[model samples]
Target: MSKTITNIHTIDLVSDFKEITKMRLAVSVVFSSVAGYFLGAEIIDFVEVLLLAVGGYMMVGASNAFNQVIEKDLDALMNRTKNRPIPSGRMSVNKALLIGSTLGALGLIILYYINPITSMFGAISIFLYVSVYTPLKTKTPLSVFVGAFPGAIPFMLGWVAATGSFSIEAGTLFMIQFFWQFPHFWALGWWLYDDYKRGGFFMLPTGKRDKGTAVQIILYTIWTIAVSLIPVFGVTGRLYLTPVSGVLILILGLGMLYYAYKLYQSRDEISAKKLMFASVSYITLLQIIYVLDKYIRIWI
Candidate 1:
């Protein structure tokens, strides 16, 4: 009986860790970094990629843990976040802080081994997310704009990790992800406006779901699609995409734009949800296509 009890306790601890760190979200963020690494790497190093993935995941996990610690009370007021580890009382704030700090230090150490620039960007991402974006959520709708700084870093972070320097290629990657976040997050904000209000978060640009917010989402969607095609024009240096790949990317963008337009026309919760999913799919598939096109071009 004691052994069974111990096993159950261990499982519960693991589950709490996953919840506190938001493991799925961390993995997706790590995927973006890996894609960027592949894009910048002339000769792929599997070991370096492995290090990047582990270190990236740790940093993202640390950010999520710290975010939960800072917003424990506010999270408890929102149904969507109320059951998270810290807010739900499954984990203590001190424990979460310890996890966050340890993960952050270890992540930075690992990234430093890859390159100092990578480590610096990793630290900056954590600081901005924890210090700036987290506190700004309740103060203004521009918090999303502030949050995009760190949110856009992962893809470019990977490139810097591979190249050990910033250049137009890295800047282009950053711009693509930066603009992409506006539409993606605005759609999520639209869907969760009421829930976010429960936590005093002014997430929407207009602080309410209206034509103004929808129009901005549409505008940013167009900008994101346009920025994504910049590589095709051969101006982004090493990041140039072939015309075929560019066309494919444009098609994917159009699909997301279609959903964005639908949300504008409907202005309903269901439409917002669809746009949210479409945006997620759009970014993930875009990264995949970029990586695939890079390798295919090399082989040919």
Candidate 2:
């Protein structure tokens, strides 16, 4: 009976860890970094990629854990987040903080082994997410703008990890992801506006569902599509995309834009939800397309 009880306790602890760290989100962030690493690497190093994935996941996990610790009370007020480890009383704040700090330190140390620049960016991402964006969420709608900086870093962080330096290629990757976040997050904000309000989060640009917010989402969606195509023009250095790849990307962007337009026309929760899912699919597919196009071009 004692052994069975111990096994159940272990499983619960693992579940709590996953909840606090937001495992799926962390893995997605790691995926972006890996995608960037592949794009930047001339000769793939599986070991290095492995290190990048683990370090990136740790950094993202740490950021999430710290975020939950800081927003425990606020999270409790929102139905979507109320059941999270910290807010649900499945984990204590002190324990979460300790895990966050440990993961953060270990992540940075691993990144440092990759390169100082990579480590520096990891630290910057954590600081912006935990210190700046987290606090600004309740204060202003611009918090999304602030949060985008950290959110976009993962893709470029992978490039730096591979190249051990910064360049236009890395910057272009950063810009693409940075602009992409505006539309993606705004769609989510629109869909969750009421829930976010309960937590005092001003996520929407206009702080409510209105023509103004929809218009901005449309505008940013256009900008994201434009920035994504910049590589096709051959100006982004090593990040140039072929015309064929560019056309494919354009089509994907148009699909997302179609949903963005639908949201504008309908201005309803269903439309917002559609836009949110479209944006997620758009970015994920875009990254995959970019990586696939690069390899195909190389093969040809």
Candidate 3:
């Protein structure tokens, strides 16, 4: 009976840890970082790539754990986040702080071993996400803009990790993801507006689900599309998209734009949800296309 109880407790602890760190989101961020690394690496080093993945995940996880600690009360107020580890009392604050601090330090140290610039950006992402963006959510809608800085870093961080320098190509990747967030998160803000309101987070530009917010979403979607296509035009160094990849990307962007347009027209939850999914698909597909295109260029 004692051994069985101990096993159950261990399982529960594992689950709580996963909830605190937001494992899936952390992994996705690592994925983007890896994609960026692949794009920038002239000669791929598998060991460094593995280190990058682990380090990126640790940094992102630290940010998330800290964010939850900071927003425990606010999280409890929201339906979507009410059951998270800290909010639900599954994990204590002190343990979470230790986890976050340790992970953050470990992550930065590993990244620094790879390169200083990569470590610097990694630190910036954590600070901006936890110190700036986390607090700004309750104070003003402009938090999204502040948040975009950190949110866009993982993609560029990967590139910097591989190259040990920041370049226009890295900047372009950052800009594409940066602009993409407005529509992606706005749609989410729209879909979860009520939940956010419950948590006192104002995520929309207009602070309401009106034509103003919808219009902004549409406009940013357009901006995202434009920025994504720039490299194909030879504007971004070390990056080029073939006509086939460009067309595919255009179709994907247009598909997302269509949903954004529908959200504007209907101003309804369903359309917002559709736009949210479309945005996710767009980013994932775009990243894949960009990575595939780079390798294709090498072969051709």
Candidate 4:
């Protein structure tokens, strides 16, 4: 009976740990990092890719844990976040802080072994997410802008990890992800606008579900579409896409834009939700296409 009880306790701890770090989200971030590594790799290093995945997840997880710790009170006020580890009372603040700090240190150490630039960006991402973005959520809509900086780093981080250089290629990748976040996050803000308001978070551009907010989403979606095609123009050194890939990317972007337009036309949650899903599908497909294009060019 005591052994069973111990096993149950261990299971609960593991569950709460996953909840604290939002592992699903962390895994998505790691995917972007790994994709970036593959894009920049001259000769793919499978072991280093594994290290990047682990380290990337750790840093993103640590940032998420710290964000939860800081937003415990705000999180409790929102149904969407009320059941998170800290807010739900499954974990204490002290425990979360310890976990976050340890994960962050370990993640940076691992990345440092890959390259200092990669580790430096990893540290910056955590600091920006925890120290800057979390607090700014309730203060101003500008938080999204501030948050975009760190959010944009993962793709470039993978490149830096593999190449150990920060150049036009990395910058192009960063900008692609950077602009993509506006529509992605704004669509989320639209869907969760009410819940976020309950937590005193002004995440939307106009601070309300209005045309102004929709307009900004449309504008950013357009910008995202534009930047994604830059590689095809050879503006990004070491990064070039074929005309065929460019056409596919444009079609994908237009699909996202179509949803963005629908959201603008209705300014309703249903439209917002569609846009949100579209954004997710857009980024995921875009990244996959990018990686495939890299190898395709080599093979052909």
RMSD of model 3, in Å?
0.9
Cα lDDT for residue 134, model 4? 91
How well is each residue in 156-268 modelled by candidate 4, as lDDT tens digits? 99999999989999999999999999999999999988999999998898898999999999999999999999999887889888778999999999999999999999999
Name the lDDT value of residue 65 in candidate 2: 96
Task: Note the Cα lDDT for every prediction shown.
Answer: 0.94, 0.93, 0.94, 0.94
Candidate 3 residue-wise lDDT, 144-190, digit = tens: 99999999999999899999999999999999999999998999999
**Which pairs clash (backbone N, Cα, C closer than 3 Å) in model 4?**
none
Candidate 2 residues 154-176, lDDT tens each? Answer: 99999999999999999999999
What count of clashes does model 1 give? 0
Model 2 regions more than 4 Å off? none
Q: What's the lDDT for candidate 4?
A: 0.94
> How high is the lDDT of residue 137 in model 2?
98
lDDT for 140 (candidate 4): 94
lDDT of candidate 1 over 38-143, digit per residue (tens)? 9999988999999999999999999999999999999999999999988888898999999999999999999999999999999999999999999999999999
TM-score, candidate 3, is 0.98
Cα lDDT over the full model 2? 0.93
Once superposed on the true structure, which residue ranges of model 4 sit more than 4 Å away at CA? Answer: none
